[model samples]
Target: MNEADALDLVQFAIWTVLIASGPAVVVAMVVGVGIALVQALTQVQEITLTFVPKIVAILLTVALSGPFVGSQISSFTTVIFQRVQDGF
Candidate 1:
């Protein structure tokens, strides 16, 4: 592949990674923020307070979004293979 083609692939790879990880990451971030807020209000400044909720939420989100993430990765793989076959 040429430089432009390589760059396109890199861009696509980034997008694929973002799409695959988006749900879990977003859920984790939201859960962390919520926990922080609760801790702030209640004066409970426990560092461990954020871990369980974030992990559980991230797990649930990943489980729920498995198909979407799988499909995105599959599509990206197909595109890559198609480009290879086409000698692009």
Candidate 2:
């Protein structure tokens, strides 16, 4: 493949990865911030306070978003395979 085609493929791969992981990352960030705020307000400066909620939230997000993420990855993979078949 030419340089442009290779770059396009790399960009697509990165975008697909970002899309697939976005929900979990967002959930984790939100949960972490919320927990940190609570800790600050309540004066409970326990570092461990952040982990459980973040983990749970990320897990829930993954569970809820699993099908969508899977479909996105599957479609990207299909496109990549098709591009290979097309000799791009």
Candidate 3:
């Protein structure tokens, strides 16, 4: 409710979002970069080549990370609700 508490809550929410998404995003980015490098080296220059692998890698990462992500989000939600109940 106070300005400082509100700011902290907002910051925590942002961090939670980043933590939740970071693994998948990082995997996609790395896959994209590697695909780009391979294309550059082989002179393939196929745009779809970049997209498909990144998508697949991200999907796999999301699948593998689902439980961890869910737990993080659930914990954050619980903390937020508890704060709300505590009159924050």
Candidate 4:
């Protein structure tokens, strides 16, 4: 493959990774912020308090977004394979 094709593939890979990970990341971030707010208000300085809620939020996000993530990865793979088949 030429440099342009390689660049395009790299860019696509990055975008696909971002798309696949965005939901869980966003949910975790939101949960973390919420937990932080609660901790600030209630003075609960437990480390586990922050971790558990973020983990649960991430898990829930993954469970809900599994199909979407799968489809995106599969589609990216298919495109890559098609490019390979087409000789770059």
Give the top-scoring candidate (lDDT). 4
Clashing pairs in 4: none
| Model 3 lDDT tens row, 14-48 | 99999999999899888988988898899999878
Candidate 2, which segments miss by more than 4 Å at Cα?
Answer: none
- How many residue pairs clash in model 3? 0
Error of 1 at 73 (Å): 0.3
For candidate 4, give the lDDT. 0.94
RMSD of each: 0.9, 0.9, 0.8, 0.6
Residues 20-56 of candidate 1: C-alpha lDDT, one tens digit per residue: 9989888988898899999989999887888988988
- Give the runs in model 4 whose Cα sits over 4 Å from its true position: none
Off by over 4 Å in 3: none
How high is the CA lDDT of each candidate model?
Answer: 0.93, 0.91, 0.92, 0.94
Ranking of all candidate structures by their TM-score, best first: 4, 3, 2, 1
Cand. 2 TM to true fold: 0.94
lDDT score of residue 36 within candidate 1: 91
